[model samples]
Target: MKKGWKLAFLGLLAINVVVVLVLLIGLLSPIKEEPLPKASPEKEAVEFHVQSNKEDLNRVIKAFIEKEKAKSFVDYNVYLRDQVELYGDIAVFSERIDYKLTFEPEALKNGNVVLRQKGIKVGKINLPVSYVLKTARDAYHFPDWVKIMPSDELIYISLDKMKLESDLRVRADRIDLKKDDIRFTFQLPIEQ
Candidate 1:
């Protein structure tokens, strides 16, 4: 109630307001943006390895098949089975599929690798490549990506046209099938 007490109360209120303003400014201040560190040109070409087990490959294939299943009208039980074999630079890929027929197509050895219709077994009969392709075309239509060459007895996947991760720019140097997992060696380049 006295002048000195009133002045002291006003001083305390001013201090509180100043403290609150300082706290608000500190909390709402913009964060500084730091540029990402650039790799030197000399070390631009860096080699990296991706080691994937059988389970990982199976899981990825299953996911892809599941996505395709919705659009696909033909009934099938197609899926990848075990480890992907790598002999030299070529990778061997195989899968089991049932298209009104249950069979495990032979391991296809094209550039990328996939399952081939050449030596697919149906029950006890081993169907020819042409027959398989004809059946697939007339009876069960395949996706646009699959290119079946009945003459060459070759089945290949068109991965070159497929879009990959935008940030990662690398080419596969070599693939090695180790005892436990598959190792993929990739050569990545740094930007100038």
Candidate 2:
């Protein structure tokens, strides 16, 4: 009986030793992790040509002015006729005076348009063009892209400076009022 008891105790001790060794090996092993993905390269910009007539361009210009009017303190209207016409009222000595400014539109190669002041009519009062432009610049809320240059007698419309959604950009290809041919190019950036 003593011999049998000694053998059973030795077997249980050997089993416990094997179990502890396995547990220690598992605890000492290093963990493995997955690698990260690489960044994608930037894609090229895509260009699309848009062609419209004077009527469509007029509607678009009217809509743009109407949209901007909501954010402006003074009301104004811009339309494409034989030339670019801007109609607005300016306050002089606490009195509102109606004014009509006609500009000859000249499209540049760098996607910008310069409106050279051809003529101006101010409510039966003969005011200097510079003074009226200065007054409009000071009083009316114009968009950042619409630069009113009083000294130069021209309004610079910087299309590149105008921001659009989805990283879109626009360029004026051609704007011939006499021919009624207006064209624009829209640049869209491709997603990576």
Candidate 3:
């Protein structure tokens, strides 16, 4: 090829290489206004109950409802139809609470509640349930001898399990809890 023609061909080749390099660089750069939407965190509600009398259990539950209602939050009633065992040292109560809750603006897609009874009688203590949620919410309170882990808050809600004298005769649409240490499975939705 002649000198002038060779020079023109080389110029064309250089322009093609520059165009390809520019295209590659633009593809690698993060484009503006194309950020992904953030994912919403999930909330779970489980009811863990301990052994107690029905009347006594209802009283505290009622108070808890009123308290939540007072805060402008909707209250849900739960169904109780399970056998429980109460001993001199300990007691256990379990129930399933399922309700369509609407907390407004930020609605909770769904919640699972595990209400566990603290096995404490109210002869005259009359302590608020919210207060109890913090200090000694269960039988698994921190021992006085050693400091409990920072996350291990003192609560009387440590319901391990209780052996039963007879078979349980209740049917939970979600789960069944016999008077023994049985690990519960699945979310319970007891239609109240």
Candidate 4:
């Protein structure tokens, strides 16, 4: 019985030694962890549709003109009726002559508005369209986005070049005077 007890004690001691060795090895081993993901610098853009009517557009355009007038004095006033009309006075031989210029507005696919010269009434006098356009281009203080081409007898409004607050961009999706349907797209940037 003593010999059997000694053998049992030896067996228990060996098992205990193996368990301690395993625990020590586990404690000394290096632990590995996954690194955190980095943030991306790319930005995304969101698009929004805006709809307006002729009356509201007229008011907004008038307000914009008024704001622009503060920067520089402009004698002309633009309004949208059946057609885009420009009412202003021009200097002819040192005399101020009132003129009404009408233009047919055409919306381009690239977010631009072109005004084709439709008619001009200069105080009961007949003047060439190109001549009148050249005079207006030279006299009026137009915004940078407005380009007047005398030879082409047209005025181009670059809506894509317009700068708005908060890095927003606008595009003319549709502009129909007869149907009174005007639509625009506003592009906004989203940061990740």
Candidate 5:
């Protein structure tokens, strides 16, 4: 080969080698994952009680239905009738939902209930409610910190996850549901 062509080839090869090495170094570098701040021992624990009535809950559901209607994913007609029953620390809720999918005939799904740490239970079938709730997160492009949990009769939103300023772990300790009102006792970790 000619001298000029040989020099050009060697120069390109050296550039390729340098690029590969830089990429390799970047891939091999240790990834530093920031640890969650530790909770302070002296911090005081906080408990919050939230209560809502059936009418208010229905209003929220209506608003959600309207929002979904605006999306127009599929032609749908949905009606949800929720009934709550209390069983000490556990609350059992039953819902009679009427839905029509696309152009098909209307169908009814009844006796849906919420299970602790579990998703919605539809009749004898169990559904991954998180998968359904994830659609909302994807639609609005929400962050991972925003958590949603849906049950057959109720939906739980983790408030602590929304708080970016503090690493506060929170969960529902007790749930009480009645014909008139639904109540929740949330337990929060002590912040540092």
Candidate 6:
């Protein structure tokens, strides 16, 4: 209302406009997105195999499972699969393992098997989280052993000079509606 007050208010408004205009210009300026480094085709295909196993490791896994079962009735039907030598000094092995309840008869038939793979780097193998299970009848659960359960597996015998162990896994190609049927690159040792 007063001349002095009006001038002061107008000056404040001018300052606000300048500030808002500067901010608008800054916001409208081009913003660059960081570019992601491109991966080479070969490097992109980098993969590792399961740990190679010799007679020693083979006997150990089998005997260990057997021993555990006899001592405590913790039944684990393990079938090794996907034995590979993806890289030098690296060995990966995988298997389909079913761990039943201490005394559940359906123990073997109540759980699911995932086709797990690993990328072996030095003495350790990095297991990936991709295993296949028979389709779930309804929920995200599988009936462990419906139709033919995966039994029997493969073992990659490593060279005598290499000190390695065998890991086993079941590889799946697709997931079923019930998550029951699974397709794999290889066949089960059971072959049925």
Candidate 3 least-lDDT 10 residues: 100-109
Candidate 1 residue pairs in clash (backbone atoms < 3 Å): none
Supply candidate 5's per-residue lDDT for 157: 40
User: In candidate 2, what are the lDDT values of residues 78-159, reduced to their tens digit?
Assistant: 8888899989886645888888999999878777788899999999877667666766776777887777777677788877
Tell me the TM-score of model 5: 0.29
Residue 172 CA displacement from its true place in model 5, Å: 4.9
Structural similarity to truth (TM-score) of each candidate? 0.46, 0.73, 0.20, 0.72, 0.29, 0.21
Return the TM-score for candidate 2, rounded to 2 decimals.
0.73
Candidate 5 structure quality by residue, lDDT tens digits, 1-192: 699999999999999999899866754544333333222232365867767665675576467556655654323323223332111111123443322111111111211123233223333544344433333223332233423332222232433443423554433333233334455444555756
Where does model 6 exceed 4 Å of error? 33-36, 40-192
- Ranked by lDDT, the better of candidates 2 and 4 is 2
The candidate that wins on lDDT is: 2
In angstroms, the error of model 3 at 78 is 3.1
**Tens-digit per-residue lDDT, 55-142, candidate 1:** 6766776677667657655444443333232111111135444322222233222214443332355444464545555445444445
lDDT of 3 at 67: 53
Which portions of model 5 miss their true places by more than 4 Å?
1-45, 75-178, 186-191
State how far residue 14 of model 2 sits from its true place (Å): 99
Instruction: Please give the distance, in angstroms, between residue 107's alpha carbon in candidate 1 and its true position after superposition.
Output: 11
Q: Tens digits of per-residue lDDT for model 3 on 52-134?
A: 44455446546654554454322334233343222112122243222211110111112112234433333334533333332
Sliding window of 10 residues with minimal summed lDDT for model 4: 33-42
Clashes of each: 0, 0, 33, 0, 0, 26
Decreasing lDDT order of the candidates: 2, 4, 1, 5, 3, 6
lDDT of candidate 4 over 1-192, digit per residue (tens): 999999999999999999899866644543332232222232367989999888999999988888876765446788888888989775655688889999989877776788999999999988777777876766677887787786688888877667789977777888887788889888787777
lDDT scores of the candidates, listed in order = 0.45, 0.78, 0.32, 0.77, 0.39, 0.30
Clashes in model 4: which pairs? Answer: none
Task: Please state the error at residue 163 of candidate 3 in Å.
Answer: 30
Off by over 4 Å in 4: 1-44, 71-73, 92-94
